[model samples]
Target chain A: MTVQDIGFGTASAQPLPAQKGPVTAARQRRTWTIYAAMCVAGLLPTLLGASASLQAAGIGLWLPGAGFLSVGGWAAVLFPLTLALFVFSLVAWFWAGMVLGPVIVWLGSAALAGAMAGDTVWAGGPYAAAFATAGIGYAFHRRNVRLRDAALAKIAPRVAFLDASLAEVRAQAAEIPDPATREMTPTDLAALRYLLDRALQPVTEWGGFDIIDQFQPAALRYQLNHMGFALGIAQTAYVPNFHGYMGQAQRNLIDKYLLRKVWGYWVYESCWGHLNFTNWDPAARDNIMLTGWFGMHVGQYMLASGDRRYLEPGSLTFRLNAKTAYVHDFNTIIGSVKTNYDSAEFGLFACEPNWIYPICNHYGLASLAVQDAVTGSDNVRRYAPGWFKMLNQEFTDEAGSIIGLRSQHTGMPIPFPTGEVAYAAFQNCFAPGSAQQQWAIARREIAPAIHPDANGKMRISLPGKGLDTGNYKSGHTGSFASILVAAKEFGDAYVAEAAQNSLDSDCGLEIRDGVRRYTGGSNDTNTYAILGQLMQAGDFRRSFTQGPHAPSRTGPVLEAASYPAVLVAQAISDGDNLRLVLYPGAGEGTQTLGLERLQPGRAYTVTGATTDAVTASPDGRAGLDVMLCGRTAVTVTPA
Target chain B: MACCAFAVYLLSQLLWPLRWLRDRLLVAPAVTASASVAWSPASVAAPVARKWRWKPALLLLLAAEVFGLGVAATAASVSAPAQPSVEFLDALHGSICSAVKGSLS
Candidate 1:
């Protein structure tokens, strides 16, 4: 009959009325009034049932503000737009299914569950059915909206260059001979395997907190990830080939150790969309932070699977958006260490999640993969953490040292048993200018007046005592002498030889060890892994200075870096100082990467051929770009 | 439940072969260390009870000293500052050093 006639409302019992004559006219008015009141009350079940379903249809449309304009802006600009698109597509599928399927069957399958759960107990089947369909539909709709936004986000400028590098890198990877047989040099794979063994020893006996005091298996897990991040290669990807299948034991260790710590670290960094991330790990947080590319490690995660989901525009946009939101709300997302302190003692890291350093590695990887997928470039990426260009200009000296920008200046105090006071803003580091960006187009000579301790150990400390400028936070004390050794070894044999000669000068104690040097920058273990990564990128070395690097107290590198002729002339010509650069202009066929006994003091020439390799002449009479070769790197001093 | 699991895990470190090793090999030789703590807490003075925060652990280190084993454990895991495992080892060495110093003093 009528809407209210269907008895939608709660019916209250009074008395049934029987009215007929004018004497009962008063009773007739009373019956009519009761009907009106009943209609209003009965409207409840219908209104209550409809509101939830209405809300469900608007699912991810929920946001901070409530306005058509605000919702439109977010839909227009927010990240992971692909997610939003997918959500819409999903919603469409559900709508189609709803139209085709039997209403009774669909409602029975869906609405019955809610009815049994008392969610829609008093409501009838139609209301329950409507609510259920609308709720599920809303979920898909919201997801699609977010994904669509992601499709429109823009890549930063530095990230663009890194994308270019990825193309070059892919071409290079193809050139590498897989087998170590038949004149093929062994790739870094072997070195990596050997590294994993020594690194993965049980932490039970670890002298520090890793094994004994409040031991977090995650500490080691983070260390492993840190190693991978530093080394620029996730060993876990190649684990199957190197080790056996990852059984339960290994998986458990990874889950317990590595995954858990990352979760905790993520929680701290995310700030739960509640607190500031500044309250988290001191090592990774930036004071005035900005857009974070470091979080895009999702790319490296799914690369081996070739799934591309992790590398998709949706993922990148979400990561970048989360970074942007956090940075905007809290501090500008810059690298943490403008200055530094001793959080390491407190088992806290000094490095921040800010992208000044290794985020470049992640960005470089992402841009490379994305470009290949989207635009089809085979180039490797040259990721540049955006902070360096801005901060160095503001805080660094002509020498690029920022001692004035330490934690002490801002008075972010640190707890101490030592006499010195440590503030949060002030970092206590023993080294200045440890990490070297490879982008040094210009050459500058830096020679600090450092001296050896009574034990003959000299520590080059920038000593955060006076650094109150940019980010002089004494975070990480980095030394990539070994990494430099690897690059110099690969780039120019002379560089390796020179590095060896420098190491030889340390004599009985410090011989040529592994590919890592002593680093007290972040966690020692994590730094070790990072040190390995830096070896690949050699994060510390700029190009050669205009003049030779003169050691503060004339250390071993001075003697080792001398000319080949200088070493042999003193041996043979009996003191005729000579200088010569070995010709490596020969073809890759003849220019031997690994060979022994390159005679110094003799004549040598280099011939140029296709594909970039070096050639050696028997006599050094005439040569093409012959500077130093083989044993002459450290042996030849700079002119 | 998580605390119980973690406790079981830590407790397992002290049982069986490790305990035996601590007693026989590591704890035997360091007679000098055990003798240092032979007296009661009041006689030694300065907050002896307070010093025993992680007593079971410090006890293992102490008991191992009597068998000459903690040194082996120490030597087995000590890493140089110049190498890759320095971070893991540095904290380890600090704890070991503290344990040793606490017992010795």
Candidate 2:
């Protein structure tokens, strides 16, 4: 069978094939069912009217103080307040994947009910038990922290001595590949298919996205941003001049980001976390999580495609409602990052209220770098030194690893999984020296984990049962994907290959209808895996710092082509001539191809098509009909 | 017993608005107040009055409370129990008492 017959040539217009196994969905359904059962069990005592204290305790299990609904007095008002608290706790749990939220709500409400009913046995007993459990949990957590710190201390000196030069890294990244001949491998095409399947769908439709949680990393917003990042890299490295489907995919992600379901959580976060109830504008204040990542996404699109549409005033407007909209474009979004950076004492602003994460700040800094590249501004030079200074001083641990998180209000550090590996690729955009140093340390640490799999293929086997933060499940897809990204950025082929292998063999790699995704991972990790696959050496840094190759700007481009029928694997131009490597996406047949940006009124020789020659229209456009059998190659040059 | 239960229920409803006023008037000032000895009664009272305009808010709070209590009383009278469900009322009373106790503790 031909490669096209094995689902490699599926069209972008068709809906993504149904997922083979909805594991996360099944798990979620089971969890919700258990929670519902618990609530139902809690209802029995209340319905029986066994005793006031018993009923109160029961109500606490369902919705705290719901018994007040039966009190038949002004006290009934308290029921709504308690119910609101319960709902807020659920939101918090989903928002951050913090199990403690629901636990606290359940136990605290139960204790409160008992106290209100003057039943020491029910309320006081559970409250004390909760405290004891917490105390034990805290003790175990501290012990783990101590062990982790001691281990890091041993590696501190080695990391400190690792040599990395910013100039060398920059010089290496400055070498751009030729735009005349660029093609994607079959693996790259499969990964691209995964992105297209989601991006080609309606912006409102969320068919392929992970909806396991709405928290920072696991949220749908993150999936959209990461998908955009992957597509941006693809556009820069492979098809620099082709802006057909890839451009649409990137724009759809940006447009989907403007949805309220994606970003409205910031409103609640603003009210309770920041104590600011007057305005709920997401981009107005200190949500670098949204503003920073989104800036890079939108800026990279403009830089790569030379599509300045998003740069238009109010072009990237986020409408909260019919009347209230935070109207912003590329400039204003980057402006928010600058404003926050200038004022922030920590040099890195907060993501969720009171929590400042250096990993997120890496995105914030990279966004500035991309903005500088796009607008010819000196944002990185102006702000990065101070930013790095604060980061080193306040946010670095004894081992020189960037601390995962710190409280913006209090100076307390919180342990998170954002180690050097997670920060390396993003940090490489602006601070290559520090990024390389991080990768060096991370490589040394991760080396021991890379061993031959059952089939003797090198694969990463991370220690312990790693957590996929996207779904709050026990999996290492995210960890493996992260290492793959870092390895690709630092030009460590061995580690990158091993990480990819691990994702392929262990992470349930599924390719259906030409789209490849690691089904074991969430939408976020799968996107990262795709990004790692798309990058060649310095692609990440170059996409942010220098953008697409210069010839891609004023070159002949393959503009119009039907999907599934004509899969343009490689479309590049060196100013005058257009070269395209096409595959029969649907089957072997004759297909029409539209070309644009040619020299007006120039006669061009076109090979591997039905017609041998064609003349450019006055508008610098031409059409060619090509016989697409297996791997059809087409080239149009001035005769 | 019924009268006492009714009184406790009324007091429980009052607690929420009282807590709101305490947060705005009492807790906010203490949190924001400077440790200077040159504090004046008029200076403090003027800002408090100007910033919150508590008079209208208090009036609104009281209005809502009255309206809620009327609705609650009407609902209770209409759904009056044959056996005089004083056990539920007593439980609610105990809840208010326990809340007060817990706060004080």
Candidate 3:
């Protein structure tokens, strides 16, 4: 009381309650106690008021309506039910407005009322608002969908091109250190590059497949020839154009050759017609002659692309008895030939169901060789000696040429051309020694038909019977092309030059953009021509004896920004050293060449037209700018 | 029915219009034929036969007939006639009497 009497303010009056511990715990407790008391005092009245209201508003004031329907029994039932339905309808209308946007539901309501009740005046106002809302929403939705679709459409082509290029890069990177494409000589490069360039030209007329079962073998042959060409082109290069053409070849192999639907008519239709042209109509699951070519194409693709994706089980499904049967592996397709090899005929294959064709059997044998190369199988080596014995014993005619066609059932040679020179090179891919022997025999026997033209270029008169030409033909450019290819394989330079010269003269040679092609020839003939040009003894021997051609470990990368359009014969990299043989196809002026897959932090010296020692950039890249023209070889070596 | 169809086929061979009708109607076209079912100039000119074997379809029809006859017999046995036997007989008698009276007059 003495301090309070002297205090001027509340602080001085309260001034100083004695300090409790470090914290005023008692003071905090007292303050909270006070707050609790005040809160209870204020909230108790509100809670009591709410409780009183709950009691007072018990189901709200009773509406001024009857507790039960105040009418007779039927009226009592119907009247309240009607009233309930009315209330429900109103609730549903309000619910619809909440759910479906106020304006959209109004349109629905207006449409229904106008149509059902003929309430035209009530419909107009709501209908207008609803339509406006719907139109705006639809426009927005359409625009969003279009924008999304357009984005996808714009990205698709670029992605596809990039994907193909990346696959090609991966394929190149996967190659082992074996017979590299760059190991080929200058002659080899010229021939293979030229043939590949020709082979990549779009096959305009594939001859329709619809006529295949009509005994029209030309259409089927056309597709097979292209298949062979596509496989051949895949061996040396993975250029985008050549790689893209493989799709067509794959389609022909699967859809046309392996597809039973295309060949199914032989089962029921021919039985009705009582017509049998060949054994091709029968649905034999393990027919070697008909199916072996497909195996060859697939094996070659495996060897070329270094992609074993197709070798997985069930990658190919075939129909037997109009039901699908899984083709498990490349071995399975190749084994079709191995399993069905005519043990009785000594490894001969049937051309049709019951008829054996020595030439077609050669393809089957070649297919086996391809299988051996791709899978490390010893089929060709295992069967070759036995096959030669059987072939010589049963299939060869008196002239030391294979009999063209023989009936497997009768064991009698059908009166066919027996043998021809055009097929000798084909056998070289599988049995080179036997093929060389065969070609020698054919050359000696057919020497009488070989005549020197006025220009001294040797031309052979083709016996039109076997090669599917009309009559005994003269000036057979296709035969010349075939002979040229065989001659090259056998290393008969004299014969090859003559044949090449004759073909150039007779078939109307066309060379533009460094691509050589015969302008006036059927697709089959042109394909043979390309094959003839590309065939080299080294490539053939390596492929037949060894496994597939191993691409280089690293290669010169074209700087895409300032890349010149050039025909690259071979781009090879060996231990960070790049060697390139390229000829300008459409490109001119100076071009920049970059080295890819080089060792990082290594310096490289580029030699050819210019020599410069340069260190690889952080991304393992080193490049030189140079001027190039026809057929220049560039080498880059690490310093 | 198959026997009748075969008999009809035999008759059709002798009559030109019936033969045409038989090919057009009785014989079904070949299914899954690579070539057309109808004769072409090339096929007609060639030695290869282009005839359809219609006997299989006829045999199928015969099997259907046997099954149909069995079903008809089973259905007939399971239910009585719509009218009672006595009523049926009375109706038959009245119809006979009317026919006889008309003939006599």
Best candidate (score: TM-score): 2
The lDDT per prediction is 0.25, 0.70, 0.45
- How well does each candidate superpose onto the true structure, as a TM-score? 0.28, 0.70, 0.50
> Per-residue lDDT of A1-639 in model 3, one digit per residue for the tens?
222321111011122333221112333455557545633443342245433222112111111001112211111222233333334433332221112222222332222222221111221322332344356559967975674454335333332333343243234223333344434343444333333332333333222121222222333434453445434443443221122333334444444444554345334333322234343333233334445655665666655544466678766555455444535466666666776774534357654444566666666777788777777887877877777656655554322345565544334345554344545555666654445444554444445667788977776655652242311123365567667666665665556676776667766565543334454443345556666665554344343334343334233343332212444455555534666666664565566665545677788777664556767787876666666776677777777
Ranking by TM-score: 2, 3, 1
How high is the lDDT of residue A301 in model 2?
90
Best by lDDT: 2
| Tens-digit per-residue lDDT, B40-65, candidate 3 | 22233322222224558767766866
Off by over 4 Å in 2: A1-148, A156-180, B1-105
Instruction: Summarize candidate 1's per-residue lDDT along A337-401 as a digit string, tens digits.
Output: 21211121111111222112222222222323333332344322222223222222322222222
Order the candidates by lDDT, highest first — what do you get? 2, 3, 1
* Candidate 3 TM-score, true structure as reference: 0.50
> Candidate 3: global Cα-lDDT?
0.45
lDDT of 2 at A505: 87
CA lDDT, candidate 2, residue A432: 73
DockQ of candidate 1 compared with the true complex: 0.01
Q: Give interface RMSD for all predictions.
A: 24.5, 24.1, 24.9
